[model samples]
Target chain A: MDIVILLYKGFTALDVVGPYEVLSRLPNAVVKFVAKQKGIIESEYSSMKMVATHTLEEIENADILMIPGSTTAFLNVVKDAETLHHVQRIDATTQWTISVCSGAVLLAAAGLLKGKAATTHWGLLDMLSKFGANPVAERYIQHGKIITAAGVSAGIDMALYLTKAVAGEAYAKMVQLIIEYYPEPPINISDFSAVPKEVEEAARAFFKKEMMKMNIAAAAMN
Target chain B: MDIVILLYKGFTALDVVGPYEVLSRLPNAVVKFVAKQKGIIESEYSSMKMVATHTLEEIENADILMIPGSTTAFLNVVKDAETLHHVQRIDATTQWTISVCSGAVLLAAAGLLKGKAATTHWGLLDMLSKFGANPVAERYIQHGKIITAAGVSAGIDMALYLTKAVAGEAYAKMVQLIIEYYPEPPINISDFSAVPKEVEEAARAFFKKEMMKMNIAAAAMN
Candidate 1:
């Protein structure tokens, strides 16, 4: 299996790695980190550097095409005609097309999520409707081969489900067993609804400020 | 704070990344991926390439030194004189010395876990005893400044707790909310003990075979 994960700055690193951990272990799996230009891409919140081993021009197709979510970077990618066009081109031939968290927003921006039941990060779930996507609050919603997962940490569960779909339940369960997919969160933070009102407000504020900054940066570059 | 995460070939990716999503958000946080060599190091299990931007020679001290775990890779690192020496040297100056999963095994191997209560991946919890470390099968056990978490996915929770220790409860909770860390595992995978006996047997068997392969590879190299 050839798993090609899209890499871009400002993406949530966990979204890429979570699914990568589960799917890269598939039999004869060869995972590649692909980006517009090769080199390192920084994670949004953490600013951790992840190297993109392949450029978009080098690899034209994927058995699985994964799009990881970002805070504001998703908007930049979606607005770019060439990148969005490339994503659409890949999705045309992909066996499985999936997006995690805000990545669904990008997928939706590419006209892929139109009329599809999809999900993204809880804080931004409502935004999906703007792009003609039916946003559900589930951890994952698999609407006919286009699997969309709810925010950051939800990607793991979504990947295991995808694994079951691709490689059977027994193999997926064994992979789960090996990784010991047990989670013990320090708080009861299941989704945006479960968080305090102040937290929700802060998240909204963060997103608004980030979007403004990204706009400024994009304008300055142009 | 300067947080240096030790990178090596065969280290578990999520074990390093999960906590990174939380800790890198700490106040004035500077995260660095450091290895013996300054370049890409593959995550042992999945072969995902993570770049090590800093070399062990370039960094002498860290406020927080993190050791991520592996399967048999931890054993190879434990036996490596220079790497163990560098870890011990760095630990001597660390305010917080921590490990995730089998990473604790590396700490124990370096004599840092001697007489210290720590934890590791649940299935291999007992293995810590050979190095004179008190293994506690909890999500994370913080004995003074030495903190260790149970298994792969447990690192995130441990880091949240670490954030509380380093910053405070409010800030930690805020970070938690930002990440939207509401985990919903498909299985009741709390720990090794919580798993069925057959699952444990299968895990053990899998580990045994991997070890055999690793040993064979080592012998072939010799």
Candidate 2:
């Protein structure tokens, strides 16, 4: 399997790293870190730098194309018309196209999620509809060739699901065991419904302001 | 807080990346990747390269020290007397020392886990005792200043737990929500006890052989 992962400045490190951890383990799988140019790339939050393996022009064949979200000034790079055009072109030829967290917004901008059910980082869900996608506030949403994972860490689930689909159950299970991904969270507040009223309200308010700013910026890009 | 993460060739990428995703998010945290030298570090399984930020000689004033495991031939690098001696010296001054997966074995070899309850990747738990640690096969184990996570992905849980301890519950919860760490496995086969007998046996056989080889290598190094 030939996998191409999009790497942009300020990209959320985990959104890509979590899935990369799983997908790169597949037998005979070739994972490439694809960016505009091959060199050092900075993470969205941390000052950490990751090296890209291939430039976008170097990628001619890909079974799966993944885009991971970023924060801070990195998000602006995704809004660039030239970059979105490139993503749209590559995604058009890929067998499976996936996005993690707010990366779904970029997919939507590329017209990949139009009229399709998709999801993103919780606070960023509403913007999906603006790009003609039906936003689903779920951990992961699979619509035919497009797979979108909610928020940052949900990329692991999407990767596992894709691994099972592409490599079979036995292979997926083996990888899962290696990762030891049996989650037992100390708090049961994974969803808004399960969280305290105050916590929920605070989260909602924080997202409301942030999402509005992102929406405005996304619109200006258009 | 100043954090130094050990970056060795053949180290498991997620073992470091998972915790990095969490700990780097802390408001005042300064995370540095410390290696024998600064350059591309290879992952154990995927053979992917991760860039290291600093050299061991440059490491000083670390509040937390983390060791991540790998399965590459590069394991020979850590076996050097100078490297192990440096690890022992720095570990003595760190406030909190931690390891993920087989990394705990390195800590134990350095005499850091002596008389401490620790854990490692389930497949290699039995070997922890060889390094003088009371090996506990839990997903995440914490005995005083030493914290060890099981296998590869459990580092995420351990990182969250550490975040809660240092930054408080509210901050940790906020980070969790941002990452959307609500795990829902499609299959119930994460634990050895939960998996089918055949699958479990197959995994044990595969890992046992690898562990034996690692044991011999580790013994020679010590």
Candidate 3:
């Protein structure tokens, strides 16, 4: 099976790595990291840099195509004509098309999430509706072959479900055992809705400021 | 704060990445991936390659030093006197020295875990005894400034605790909320001990075979 994970400047690391850790272990799986350009792709929130093995144009088909989200960088991706065209091109041939976190915005931007229930990073949940997607708050929602996971860490859960769908329950459980997928969060917050409203507002403001900065930087580059 | 994560050929992706996703977001945190060589480092089971930001020798001190695990590659790392010496040198200076999964084995081999209670991947818990370290099956255990986490995904939980220790509770919860880290595993297995004995045995056999293969490859290279 050929699995292609999309990458762009300022992409979130865990959004892709969490799913990669689980899905890459599938039998006969060959995973490729593809970006607009071949070489290093820096993350949005971390100093970590991953090497893109192939260019987006180079990969025309994938058994699975994964799109990982970013805080503000995804806005640029959603607005790019060439990238959206490629996402649509790949989606045309994939057996499974998945997005994590704000990545759903990119899929929804491409018209793939129209009339579909989807989920994304809590901060961006309402924005999905602007692109014709029904924003839900679940960990993950599968509408046909397109699976959209809630946030950064939700990709791990979504991948296990995808594994069960592609392979069998037995194989998925074995993979879970191999990774020791038992999660024990140390934080006291059980529900994101329960978080202080001020904190959520502050985070949203930070993201908005970041988007403005990204726009300035992009304009300067042009 | 300067955070240095050690990487090697065939290292597990999630062992380090899980923690990176959490810790890299700490206030004023700068996370660096370091290896013996400064270049692309490949994972044990995946085709993913990460760029090492600095060579091990270039970095002598870190506020936090993290060692991520590999299935068979860790055996090579433990056997190398130079690598063990570097680990010791870095551990001596770190405010916090940590390991994930079999990374505890590397710390143990370096004499840092001697007479200390630590934890590692469930399959290799007993191996810590060879280096005079006590192994437990908890998600993570901290002894003084050193923390050892169990298995792959445990690093996320361990990092949340470390965040609380360094930055306090409110900041940690904010970071947790930023990532939207509410985990919901799709697999039904709650406790690893409840897994069928055959499945665990099969996974162990697979690791052993991979270790043997790695040894043969090392011999050929030498």
Candidate 4:
């Protein structure tokens, strides 16, 4: 299976790597990181670099077309017509079209999620409506072949679901065992609304500062 | 804070990326990917290449020194004198020395886990005792300045625990929310032994075949 993961500058590492780590383990799975151009792609943090092995134009088809979201860079990619055209082209041949976090935004922007229910990162969940996509508050929602996960870490769960679909219950269990996917989070968050206002505000401010820092860095690079 | 992540050939991607995605969000965190020599570090699966920004010789100290594990390659790294020497040197300066999966094997091999209770991948848990470290079946165990997490996915939980320690509860909660870390696994395995015998065997065989394939590719490269 040719699993093509679309990459772009300033993409979030875990958004891609979370699912890549799981999906890459499937039997006979050939994973490719495809970008606008094949070369080094630095993450939004600018601390890690992953090599994109293929270009968007080079990978004509894929069994799985994965779109990973970024912190703020997703906004730019959503507005880029050429990237969306490539996404549409790749989706035409995919057995499964997957999105993680704000990646659903890209899919919605490409007109694939029009009138369909999808989900993304909590912060950007409502933003899907702007693209004619109904944002669901679930972990993931599948509309035929397109599966959209909630956010960054949710991709792992989404990929496991995909694995069971393609592989088997037994095989998926084995893969889960191999990764030791038993999650024991030290803290529990039952409700996001219940979180302290100060904490939520601080989190928002932190991301805003980070996006500004990344923008400054990107501007410097240009 | 200088957060140094040691990278090497044949290491598992998620074992490192899981913790990295969480820890990199810590306030004022400076994350660096270091290898024996600074360049492209191919994962065990050979599907991805992560650039190691710094060389082992160049980094003098780190506030948090993270050691990620590999599959069969951990055995080779555990036996490498120079690598162990570098790990020891780095550990001497770290406020927290952390390991994920068989990464504990590397820490134990470096004598950092001597007579200490630690955790690693379930498949390799017993091997820790051989290095004079007690192997616990828990998700993670912390001893003074050292923390060892159970398998690949467990590192995400372990890192959250560390995030709380460094940045406090509210900040860690913010990080968790940013990552949307509310996990909902599609399936659950309450007991490893209860899994069908065939499924367990298949998983083991799959890993063995993959390791051999990697060995063959490594030989070809040589």
Candidate 1 Cα deviation (angstroms), residue A55 = 2.3
In the range A11-109, model 1's lDDT, one tens digit per residue, is 888888888888887878898888899887777854367878888878778899999997777877877887788789988889999999899998998
DockQ of each candidate's interface versus the true one? 0.56, 0.53, 0.68, 0.65
TM-scores, all models, native as reference: 0.92, 0.91, 0.94, 0.94
- Docking class for model 1 is medium
Please, what are the lDDT tens digits per residue for candidate 2 over residues B79-125?
66776776787787787888888888888878888899999877667
Cα lDDT tens digits, model 2, A1-222, are 788898888788888888888888776778888888898787754457777889888887688899998643435855688778878888878889999988998999888898999998877787788889999988898999999999888999889988888888887887788788887665556575565666555555555555466664433222
lDDT of 4 by residue, A41-85 (tens): 998878798989998999889999999998888888988999999
Leading candidate by TM-score: 3
Off by over 4 Å in 1: A45-47, A216-222, B45-47, B216-222
- Model 3 ranges with Cα > 4 A deviation: A215-222, B215-222
Greater-TM-score candidate between 3 and 4:
3
Tens-digit lDDT string for candidate 1 (B125-189): 77788889998878888998899988777888999999988988767777787666777766545
Which CAPRI tier for candidate 2? medium
Task: State candidate 3's DockQ.
Answer: 0.68
Best of the two (2, 4) by lDDT: 4
lDDT of 3 by residue, B1-222 (tens): 999999999899999889999999888898989999998888885468888999889997999999999877898898899889999999999999999999999999999999999999887888898899998889899999999999899999999999999998777877788788878788777768878777677666666667678664423211
lDDT-best of 2 and 3: 3
Which candidate number has the best DockQ? 3
